[model samples]
Target: MAKEIERKFLVRSDEWRTRAVSSAKLMQAYITVNEDRNVRVRLIDGTSARLTIKVGKSAMVRDEFEYEIPVQDAEELTSSAIGIVIEKVRHRVPIAGKTFEIDVYEGFYSGLVVAEVELESEEDHFERPSWLGEEVTGDRRYSNMMLATNDLASELIHGVSHQAL
Candidate 1:
């Protein structure tokens, strides 16, 4: 069994932008591999794909399992998804000695910027950048999987102009 433990935080400022290296801009289609539990696959950088399975009894510690798969397989599974499509550009930024993934969303939910940090363990401590805001680690709305099912741009943030610098 693979366990993925990580902490999520909101971006606090645009400082991280200048430091971020543009990774890739890709269109992703997702489906509910297990909607009841929160398991899904994300295809990034065109051909690279990852299957993320999150399981946990509480919000603090979640067992996340990520596996690499073929993008074609992942695309085929998108048909199994309940509904909705998500689009975003992934950026890699090094902050606080850790690599943070900053997702700048587009398409239906544009102007939404979300930053996520994966930890070795749930209790692992990390340097929180000033640009990081409220912690939405446990919020399902911020989860990439749920983001596919719910158009939460309006729900996560009212209206903001999100762009990569």
Candidate 2:
């Protein structure tokens, strides 16, 4: 099984922009989202797409399976997604041998920026950049599945600040 282990954080500054190696426009939506698992369809750069299934009850780790799918199918799935579709620009910033995915949200989630880094293991060590803010690794409100289902107001009430930067 494929295990995904990552840490999440709110972006506090724009310093990461300077170090960004590349960026991709991403649109994703959940097909099914529940406490136990999530099924997501993601289109990247309007060219490629992926269908991902993640299962597990833990916030820090999950069993992930991803498959490349036709962009047309992905687009169709996105339009029929369960709730709000997620729109964001992901910038790949490499720092201290680790690449951080800094996502700047758009649309209904404008002004929210998050940074995430996948680790080799749960115990892997990594350096935190100055632009990274409070750790939200285990915060369910920050989870993409929850973000797709809830609005800004609901997220704020759950401790996700609009003034994150």
Candidate 3:
């Protein structure tokens, strides 16, 4: 199993932009947006079909298996995916002797910036780059999977509502 252990954080400033290489813009939308549907057809590195269920706040139960579906069938399945859309560009930069990915969102999440660092293990250690701000790992609100399903404008509204209250 390929374990994807990583830490997320808020970018302190835009200085990291100087180190950016290029960015890939993408917009992915889930079919339903707020449901817990777990069936997914992921085209990562290679083509694969799998079913994953959220196990916890930051964990998922994934089972990748063989697939024999045709392209049309595959598209149909993916089209039914709950609002899993993410529209953004990923900025790659080297920081602290390691590569950090900064995601600049667009569309509904136009002003949000998130950074992530992948690790070999959950216990991995690393230097904190000056540009990295507070760690947001385990913060549900910062999770891209959640953001894909949420209304970006609603988040801003609630943020201001909290201050007013």
What TM-score does each of the candidates earn?
Answer: 0.80, 0.93, 0.66
Error of model 2, residue 84, in angstroms: 0.5
State the lDDT at 16 in candidate 3: 81
lDDT of 2 by residue, 26-111 (tens): 99999998888999999999999999999999999999999999999999999899888998899999999999999888776777
User: In what order do the candidates fall by lDDT, top score first?
Assistant: 2, 1, 3
What is the alpha-carbon lDDT for the whole of candidate 1? 0.70
Q: Residue 136 of candidate 1: its Cα lDDT?
A: 82
Model 3 is weakest, by summed lDDT over 10 consecutive residues, at 156-165
* Residue 52 shift from truth in candidate 2, angstroms: 0.3
* Best candidate, TM-score: 2
Per-residue alpha-carbon lDDT of model 3 for 89-136, expressed as tens digits? 778887666678897766767667778887766777888877787787
Off by over 4 Å in 2: 157-165
The full ranking of all candidates by TM-score, starting with the best, is: 2, 1, 3
Q: lDDT of candidate 2?
A: 0.88
Which regions of candidate 3 fall more than 4 Å away from where they truly are? Answer: 31-81, 152-165
